[model samples]
Target: MAPIKNGRLLFNEVPTGYPIPGRTTVYDGSGTIDVESEPLNGSILVKTLVLSVDPYLRGKMRAPEAKSYNPPFALGEPLYSHGVGKVVRSEHANFKPGDYVYGSLLYAEYFVPKDVSYLQVLVRPEPSLPWSVYIGAAGMPGQTAYYGWKAYSKAKAGETVFVSTAAGPVGSMVVQLAKQDGCKVIASAGSDEKVKFAKEIGADVAFNYKTTNTEEVLAKEGPIDIYWDNVGGSTLDAVLGNVAPFARIIICGYISQYNGEEPYGIKNMRQVLTNRVAINGVLVFDHHARYEEEFYKVVPKKLATGEFKYSEDITRGLDKGGEAILEVQKGTNTAKKVIVVAND
Candidate 1:
């Protein structure tokens, strides 16, 4: 068999703003993997299938020494993050060709993992849910949404929960999950179309935040008992003022502030004090001890019963990864951004 032709996107220069195309990162058009060569007992080579292009990746595109939950993407090296791939060659005892897997892998057509620490064999494949979904709503994002809200919000039946970015992969799932939990849901989106989409997915009331006054809307919606925030700029400020006493605020992501040189300062943080709000910032990795147990026990059941539905905004090639990242950061992608790097 011929060695595989490997193509991958490498982090190039750091971007001070929206990562400029081909400037911050560039796709290495072609390279190779010696499929004919011997492999270590634990090594597995995978052909990339689907990759998730998420906003959090933006924060990671910094100098290698920069501090964060994830180490920075080393310059001129292959970019890596949550993606789904299929094992084509394996020396690993547990993996075999035709097995679909998910992990923190490079955005490459083909590659070998440095170790198995970050990869997991997919127990279930797609068609029931597209294989790409392992990188979308049913994947990391879904787990993040489910765990984040459940862990912090303490949502009870008859209470109301408000979520921002309600049409996004994680936020969209939050709407349905909260409703399924018997919590009344109020959701907000950037556009009118997204507003309707949020409702179609289960938001009790969905509003276009761009045109509406958030403070007024929340006031009319009544005192929100929990805020499942996906964006943490002015909306966080507004919700601060309208929340009920002892309301829970789950900090999921601040997409609104991710690209900003200067953050939108919250004017109502004082409310966090006086309103007795419980604000907790959640990073998915922080809760990995419970990942396998929580994810398999929850998402699979919801998925099987037709109770879970999500959308993906796909970019169709390994080379298009850069464009997909920009689409997500700029809030232009219509749904969850998953890059289709290869056929499953």
Candidate 2:
């Protein structure tokens, strides 16, 4: 067979408002790596299987650069995301062809490694397990959920826990963990379908925040003990006013304010002061000590049994990444959004 030519999703423009697919993101260009040639020293050639489209990447798309934890994607550079792939060629000692790996890579169908020292060759999951799980549940999103929820929320059994945006990758996992840990989980999503999906995944009560009055709903749900804060706009304000004393508010994400167009003002600082709620932000890397327990012992067992379920809204082909990201940015994606480059 001939060598495969690869297409790439490039960051074409930085948007002050919401990202426009074809304008801010362009997918017209491609680059081909001749398989006949060699990869760099210790570089591995990988055929992309799954590419993660996370909300955080939208922040990175800006060029002038916000004061962020990660750098902005350079203009004309291919958009990069968390990706899982199979090694097609390797120039390293530890990696070999046919091994599965996951790391940050461009939205290209294949890797042309010049400086990818951060890539890791992963061990294959069970034959029955879907390889795409590495890009979602067993990957960064899940890790973010697991560590973030446990580390900050410190939720106890029989506690009333409320999670906003409960249908997202991290939020959905947070819902299940709170439920399985014996907490009474009350979750909300922007859409009705997302609210239903949250209920299906172990939330005791799930409501469409767009349709339901958030304050009225929480007023009935009573004094939430833990608020796994995902959307940090008016929702955070509502949680702050409605939570119990000493409640823990875990700041995992702020999907509502990502586009930087409509900045929400939080006016309920007095509630936090009176109630003594703890608001803590989480980064998945800060809790790496639990990685072994989660990857090896916990998550696999939960997956093997019927105790856990994860949803992935997989868009096919690398060309669709631009549109998929736009969907993610607008609070429309109901599941973990990943681009399926190839799934064998």
Best by TM-score: 2
Q: What's model 2's overall lDDT?
A: 0.82
> Candidate 1 lDDT (Cα, whole model)?
0.84
RMSD in Å for model 2: 1.7
* lDDT (Cα, 0-100) at 233 in candidate 1: 85
The clash numbers for all candidates, in the given order, read: 0, 0
lDDT (tens digit, per residue) of candidate 2 on 209-310 = 888898998899968999888779898888888889998899988878888758888998788879898889987767868664655457755765758788
lDDT of 1 at 212: 88
- lDDT tens string, model 1, 188-284? 9888878888999888888988898888889999599999888888889889889899999999898887774588888888988888899999988
Worst 10 residues of 2 by lDDT: 292-301
Clashes of 2: 0
* C-alpha TM-score for every candidate: 0.94, 0.95
